[model samples]
Target: MNLESPKVTLDKSTEETFNFLSDVKNFESLMPENISKFEVLEEDKFLFALKGMPEIILKKKEAIPNNKIVLGAAGGKLDFSLVADITEVATDKSEVQLTFNGEFNAMMAMMIKGPISKFIETLATNMKTTV
Candidate 1:
């Protein structure tokens, strides 16, 4: 399944936003307030558990300087890629778009689409204000 987050205009520059996202630990700030657990396993990897979901580990796959950051699951029940795209709007402003691409069977996708889509949207929305 593929989900695209709502575009967000950030007060920081593209480079600044990209730099922040390049560090996997920074994502803890973007998670829901009710998250049950968050652990940084390494500089480029971390695990976070939501209230009802199993802990998921995310690892930094690539950083495209001032352009994008690619992250993916580090072996678990769920496999997915979370990409952050940064576009410069001005010297000190930027627009960010987040996309989630998950590898799921048709049955699983049909069952989790609603909540997963909402989760992706929430992540995008939070990034707007959090950054």
Candidate 2:
């Protein structure tokens, strides 16, 4: 399954935004408000659990300089990757799009689609305002 967010323009430059996202600790600012727990596990890993969801660990899988960041599930029931695509718009502005890619059976997708969609959308929304 693939869930994507609408592109959002940010008030910072691509370099600035990329630098911000390069740090795993910064992701806390982009999480959903209802997250029950959050912890930075390592330099490139973090753990979080949202309401009604089991704890999940995410680690930086790859980064393409100031262009994109790919975070993959380190250990969890579901396998997924969250990517942040950044594009330069101006000297101090950029546009970002968030994509959630997961391999889920039809039944699992149906069961979690709503929350998963909301989770990615909320992260994208928060990035637009606070990233």
Candidate 3:
């Protein structure tokens, strides 16, 4: 599996950050608003209805409050897992780190990284505002 981990610091309390990030709906809102249709399978899962390489629906198979969340995707040309953890640095600051570990060929890995990075950046931006 190829691994890519990125961290983003936000000016928000741990509780406040968790309060927003812990909710699946908030995460969906952070996604590209242009996605034509979106389906949320549960409190921590959603499907992205768009056309793209290795395009596959994603589901939040696991989540731990204020700590970690995991998402699974399988279909199209990809099968992968996205996991993220949140850590508190102070009363009004926190750091969110995400690790992408999955079994995908190098070519596919390179293709998916750009969009996924942007998506995560968007998540950080949105969380910054919400928290």
Best model per TM-score: 2
What residue runs in model 3 are displaced by over 4 Å at the alpha carbon? 1-6, 50-55, 74-77
TM-score of 2: 0.96
For model 3, state the Cα shift of residue 49 in Å: 3.2
Q: Answer with 1 or 3, whichever has the higher TM-score.
A: 1
Span of ten consecutive residues with least summed lDDT in model 3: 47-56
Which consecutive 10 residues in model 2 have the weakest lDDT in total?
122-131
lDDT per residue for candidate 3 within 69-101, as digits (tens), equals 777774555677777678988878888876666
lDDT values for all models:
0.87, 0.92, 0.67
- Judged by lDDT, which candidate is best? 2
For candidate 1, lDDT tens digit of each residue in 23-92? 7788888887768999999999999988887788889998899999898999988889989889999999
TM-score of each: 0.93, 0.96, 0.74
RMSD values for the candidates in order, in angstroms, are 1.2, 0.9, 2.8
Native-vs-model 1 lDDT? 0.87
Q: Write the per-residue lDDT of candidate 2 for residues 21-111, one digit (tens) a residue.
A: 9899998999998999999999999999998888989999999988999999997688999999999999999999989999999999999
